[model samples]
Target: MVSSKIIDRELFERILEKKNSLDKARPLSAEIVQKLRQEMEIEWTYNSNAIEGNSLSYEETRRVVERGLTIGGKSLREHFEAINHVNAIRFIEKLVEKKQKITEQTILEIHSLIVKGIDGVREKGQYRSGTVFIGGAVFTPPPPIELKARMLDLIDFVNKNPDKLHVIELAAISHHKLVWIHPFVDGNGRTARILMNLLLMKKGFPPTVILNVDRQKYYRRLKEADRGKSKPFVDFVARNVERNLDLYLKAIKTGKDEQYISLQEATRHCDYSQEYLSLQARNGKLEAHKLGRNWFTTKKAIQAYLKKHATKNQKLKFIQ
Candidate 1:
């Protein structure tokens, strides 16, 4: 697993910086921010599930989030059902079961089980992914024997420094380190992203999804971090987190003020049909506040969706 010396004083500082939400916040009016939050939450789930190969179109995906389940497919569907939720499960488990302590074993166990369904193709229970990138250059991994010890050391560092530094920063570090190790044979990218989310969730922050659409920007950020730079990776993670918060805050703001937007309104702002929007809200799958009989969602959710899932082979769009 991980070594004792990795979580030294310096690593702790980076964690602190990442977790102090207020320190780097750009600050926005409560009204604007809340709307963004509501929108991002709804949209991120849809897009993240899609890239995981969920195969649901915009409306169909919304309907599934609302009421349908693709249980017939490989376990991928079930896993996709809560592709965004495993982080929440990990958070509660850590706090309630492990009492806020992290160890190399804890990290491995979390990863092994969470991605279990993707085994053969992705080494569901594996690590490193046997994939390597020499500063943005993808290359075949070196023999596993050569890097196993370093990978173990990284794990040890993570467990040792559990609470001193911010989890987010550690997450960013682990993500880069794991990729560098190329420990597993597949699923490194997805696994790394989930590990990052686990870090945020450990600290009571919402898990962030780096959408496939943003793959270029996301890889660029990772490449920057591999250069042994801090801000670019931290900034990249911060942006993803803030994007999530913007959606949550938007929904929360309107949710607090009882501000309301309707399905037609949201879809118009988006491009989905009123029926599609209603199915989403009616089933309580999306973030929307109801006014009498009508409900409306913030624009962030809609934009993120349009950005990620609109394609030629749309999934079924009917409301369940």
Candidate 2:
């Protein structure tokens, strides 16, 4: 067995620290929480559905979710997907509020809302009775007969958290494992992502969205997990968790350092070009996150990076 670490321990701890900061600031005014929640719900719906190939643009999804207005050019399935995802998120929020345990029925119910009008009633929340295959996936899902047993085992693993994994790790693994099982004929991916956030929210983390812009890298990480290198997938999820935490912290203005600016705006304060900063962000050298196609980082992060590198270079010059 490769004893290689399964996640960036430093980054993971940094995320936990941010979660701690958010927790300490809890009981944020109801109005602020409500506004942030509304924004995140729309974003979560749009991105999750888009990742599943829904054609509605972000604005169309906002209209569908917020105003119940359908787009003229989009198909009925796409509209339903956007609306249903919002409904599913609301359902998960209620469960989180009630501190409910994640049962098999709960999973089915979330899936039910996700595919309500798009899929037939028999397949709405029900596990597939026939085999299904994921295009571009490295492995086939377990056969239908194995799904129930596999789901039960998954529920046990999540509920018990037998390995005592951190909540983030548990949620990430559960996300991949549910997709690995591919229990439902459709809506498996959406359900797994929702279920993953449900675990996070129940643990006091804000709702995390896996952006549509990340669709390709997201699949690649999942495929890596399938090949027994789960670290990449876990790190990917953790980065997203940090992103949402940054959003929450910023929304409340929890601290001055939490202010995040777009890479373009951030460039005005730093020596490096936006492209170079984006590269550093992608390589994990900078503390930043992507919102859609744009990357955002704090002035503090830029200053820290420059300070660290400048000192390193000065030491090398001294040695020379």
Candidate 3:
């Protein structure tokens, strides 16, 4: 059924062009790259765990992962989830650096890292021993007996079709298929997301963080994929990927200075509501464009607009 789904070639090419253009721009220094990776490591772990109902707040997750401090209200498992995810991220980074191939062994090892202390020793890194149902999901995962065969088949498909589909499509489909399998008793979503990033990183793309704000939409897209339509999920993933690329490109060009940002982000630096900003963007009063579904513009653009509109008695406020 996934094969039957139509690929949005136009959208895919558009995202690819943005990605390639960023790659062609000035190369980021190693220090800047590492700093960006560290920041994303925190965001990626926090968002991935939060989507799965982990009780740790983003700040709490940062404390647990970076500061190694325990939160007062969070359970040990929640803390472990945060810590383990960071370790798993580190593991994946090593795997990427080594240019490792995706295989059952790698998947299991990653799972092992993710559930090291949270799951039973027997369950850690092992496939589910029984059928699993996702609450409110439109489709159920395959039974345990079929998981191995299905996983192998999926791997074979990915390996054989490397040249058939674009890398983003390949990674997106792999993510959907992994979730459909629901290979482990726990951590399936987290593992699938990490693995998807693994594939993306392998292709020299940045890792995507599906923000907690988008959790509902993320699940909705996954459900759409389950019903044999993969485009929505693929498009969702691509948008996130595009957003990350935009951020990284902007950061590299601006050296952590004020740069292009989404309307929601821009609101923090200005007096305009997101709705007002959207209108301004639509009217071309602000130099911005709709990337995916959100409008993006630089701080300089906003500053210029303010200066042009400032009254003689009023001083223009710029983003600081």
Predicted model with the maximum TM-score: 2
Query: Candidate 2 — which residues are off by over 4 angstroms?
Result: 1-5, 119-122, 254-320
lDDT of 1 by residue, 156-221 (tens): 766665545455567777777776666665445555665666566665565576776776776676
**C-alpha lDDT of residue 302 in model 3:** 75
Tens-digit per-residue lDDT, 1-320, candidate 2? 11113558788778878987888987786865876787788889889988999988877888888899978988888888888888899999999989999999999999999988873547888999998898899899999899999999999999998877888888999999999999998889999999999999999999889999999999999998998888889889989999999888875655555566678877777667789989999998988865544576777777777777656553233210
**Tens-digit per-residue lDDT, 132-225, candidate 3:** 8997798778889998899888788666765477667788889989988998888888988888899888878888989999999988999989
List where candidate 3 sits over 4 angstroms from the true fold: 1-10, 119-121, 254-320
Give the distance in Å from residue 291's predicted Cα in candidate 3 to where it truly belongs.
18
TM-score of each: 0.56, 0.79, 0.77
Scored by lDDT, the top model is 2
How many clashes in each candidate?
30, 0, 0
